[model samples]
Target: MSIYTIIDADTHVTETPDLWTSRAPAHMRDSVPRVITDSRGTHRWVLAGGRNLASAGMTATAGRGTFKNPPKTYEEMHPGAYDAKARLKYMDQMGIWAMVMYPNVGGFGAQQFLKLNDPELMLTCVQIYNDWQTEWASADSRRLIPITSIPFWDVAAAVTEVRRCAAIGHKGILFTGEPQYYGLPLLGDKHWSPLWEAAVELDLPISFHIGSGDMAEGLVKERVATYGKMAAFTELAVDIFLRNGLQLNDLLMSGVLARFPKIKFVSVESGIGWIPFVLEAMDYQFKGNSVAEEHPEFDRLPSEYFARNVYACYWFEQTAPRRLIDKIGVDNILFETDFPHPTSLYGDEVHARIKGGLSDCEESVRRKILWGNAQKLYKVTGPSADDEAKL
Candidate 1:
């Protein structure tokens, strides 16, 4: 293992085709999620009621190397993408001490399941994913940290599931930045306070993955047809970053952070390059509006609250770490390797990128971004006493 105890704040788990079918209730088994080969020879996931969710391309391209053009089949993927034991081995090879795992088929925050006509079946699918995650993390609890997803359609059910998942060992919860996409209330509405409160009470950090909200699928298609696959991928990345910025603006301007001071918000897979600009603009806007008269709940400027509660992660970022680390506060920065994704840093590249990004920084800041921030945010422990003794 490498010298540093790196904790990847964002990673993914490709769900097995039987994930939903095997655990689903007997009455719902016929309609749960399953994989099917299309006439074009591409594997796709079809949810309950026969709705096509996503192709196998994005979910199973981990070990395909530079050949990420058409996306590979599940059989072509490395076992590490789905198997717990194999994943740990991959982590060992990469020197990643731990990772907060998110879902692929679940739409980063399980948002895809909301399309189901039956809310009960949607909730059941979510529970099965959570339970399966718990089992996966059990392979090496200290190394494979699972982040759970809840039923966003019902506020009460979300709260209940949040508590239940935390009790069962989930370190964090993946939440959609735009709940209105599912016809639910916005993040700032009083409707979300109960879920936020439960997250705080359980000490579970709320993670918002890019593209987990109201994603524009048509934009991706247009970009690919006109500009090619690489350009299409770039468009998707840019869209996720822009939307995540809007979500951050909403959280800050909406007084959510002000009301829930103890809770933490993690911007997963969203780079930190734009954080300084956003905070600077927020401060200017807050002052320009004469803060108290407009948003009295905000006791201080938006940047101040962000410095204290919000965290933004970076993987391939080179300039942000050098220029904005001090501005964002070292404690509010985390590191990640998107891992099996098309944009991921594979093998030793993760370490090299992290090292190069933090080259001009101090050891303390490097330590925090590499692993310290995650350890505190997730309450992660170990290289356990036994492991340490052996080391």
Candidate 2:
């Protein structure tokens, strides 16, 4: 039996070398993502047309003990990153009862599929990833919650994928934050209305992971060009964390929440401290700029939509709990480790880190952030009723 009740609200799995090629049809073996060792002996994934899929070694830092250089080959990284059974053991050791898992090869939002010129192949790639991920989570369905990616380029298909994955036990949807960048209609447009309706019907929360938006891609390019790669990553480690703030602002103002009152939106891997700041700005600007006059459909203050439908997660954040949990709202706040990825809360000291960061709050508040809330949000099930009592 487990000794703790911590549920990681967001985490990731490093896609195995043959994740796609093994699952794809014989025809798709060449076009789908596949690992290849180049002449220089460096391992990299390539798409059709031999386009090099650029990756940062930081994507899989588990068991390296330090977030240092890339591991060059799949053998150098930890099995927990790609193996379901291995991750369960790691979760047990870390005292995490459950985790919400996302994918790596597909981009946080599966945006990489957008680059595929063949629209049929692009949608099939999305389906393939989701199907494989579901099988991965089946290793332990109750504790390993799988989030599904959609063929967002086609909202009609996106709606179908959501329902199909939901029927097979996917708890939520991972989507790009800025659809406008993909040449699709924005989330607020009627074009995405069916997708939103499907999400509400399925009772699935929609998560927007950091850097899931094309806006983040644009930001990454501009910053790297200005500061150069090394300095931008080192000097602005917090930059990636902040991109979700823009997503939240757009979401709150988009009227989607108002239109679809039951849908929940999550800002995954984004910290809590900036949320109050963003909400404050949204409410202030809404009034100061007379924004309601421009969009009268917005029936309430922007901040009001947050606790009811918007959620944000935090890890390694000490100040937010001490100063702003109330402003951020306990129900809207979630806890995460972001394990096996860059700056994840892995290793022996992780328990102390979690304790130290959340120490000031009462146990009830802590329990909600750590376990209760996510369980309710993601519909996490059990080790059975009796066993759960001990937790």
- Give per-model TM-scores: 0.94, 0.93
User: Could you give candidate 1's per-residue lDDT for residues 102-172 as a string of tens digits?
Assistant: 99887887888767778899899889999999999999988889887988888899888888888888999
Clashing pairs in 1: none
Give each model's whole-structure lDDT: 0.83, 0.83
TM-score of 2: 0.93
lDDT of 2 by residue, 98-181 (tens): 999988788888888888878888989999989988999999899999998998888888888899999999999999888887
For residue 52, model 2's alpha carbon misses the true position, in angstroms, by: 1.6
User: Compared to the true structure, candidate 1 yields what TM-score?
Assistant: 0.94
lDDT at 290, model 2:
91
CA lDDT for candidate 2: 0.83
Each candidate's root-mean-square deviation in Å?
2.0, 2.5
